[model samples]
Target: MEPNDQPAPLLEGRFEGRNDFIQLVRDALGVAAQAGWRELILSDSNFYDWPLGERAVIDSLNAWARGGRQLTLLAKSYDEVVRRHPRFVAWRATWGHIIQCRACPNADALDVPSMIWSSDWVMQRLDPVRSVGVAGTEAGRRVAARELLREWIENKSAPGFASTTLGL
Candidate 1:
């Protein structure tokens, strides 16, 4: 099924308002668990504005893992600095089950613009592939995503991606 065919799992927004962040995280985790997504890409390069966004994301990831589901978190490597802090160590442990990827080469940060741009590049990449599925293992999906990215670039005239992009 398509990622949208199933509900798009909750991804914490850029801001986390103190206690509200907890609820946001809980909700995101709930959606993820229910969706049974194998990978979850999170972009926190902008979390610099909301100091608590990162923490909330980690907390929500923990809650998602606790539910006994697999999820891959996509973020820049720098965020690991925050994760390595003593304060974040415990939360990290709870998040041990989730996989994280640096979105630099893949999708960059998880903002709307980035996602838009990334999807175009991704759609272009996948356009050439005979088939694709996001429900597969992380490794499998990454490989497929790459293959599609290549196809997307190689064949620019493809019909589905003609739109100039909404502004990712």
Candidate 2:
């Protein structure tokens, strides 16, 4: 390996197709757990198409669910998630202490980027319909991706997506 090569080669660069998107999400979660990344941020309009319910993702998440590590989910709405990602919903309930979910109801759906971000890697779907986007470890691109996610979460969202609800 070159001196600069990452210990684990990432599925880096532009990717197109739904299969690629799902694979990238899975790969990121697996790598994050193995690398002990400090945090992960997932943002989407509604996560209507993400593969968060898969068993492999749950396994990686289970591995990543240790103390002091944080995971945040930002979305215009999680209704789709609740409906589509039942496995993820169950996992979130078990790891609620380390997971934070935010709702961006007022933000335009089109303005919200569909992406997953971590200190070491990021994948963003520039065109959600086609599942086309880019992912990599390029420092400048990672910085920019982090900035965009932070802006939407801090400025346009609020506490939401409770793990449980009480029917009065």
Query: What are the candidates' C-alpha RMSDs?
Result: 14.6, 3.2
RMSD of 2: 3.2
Task: State TM-scores per candidate.
Answer: 0.35, 0.92
Worst 10 residues of 1 by lDDT: 119-128
Query: Best-fitting candidate, measured by TM-score?
Result: 2
- Writing each residue's lDDT as its tens digit, candidate 1 over 29-116 gives 4455445544443333322322233555455445556544443322333344353443344554545544332333243343211111
* Regions of model 2 farther than 4 Å from truth: 1-7
Among the numbered candidates, top lDDT falls to 2
Per residue, candidate 2 scores C-alpha lDDT tens digits across 1-168 of: 245545466778899999999888888888888777889999999998888999999998998888589999999999999999999999999999999999988888877889999988889999998999999999998999999988888888999999887898
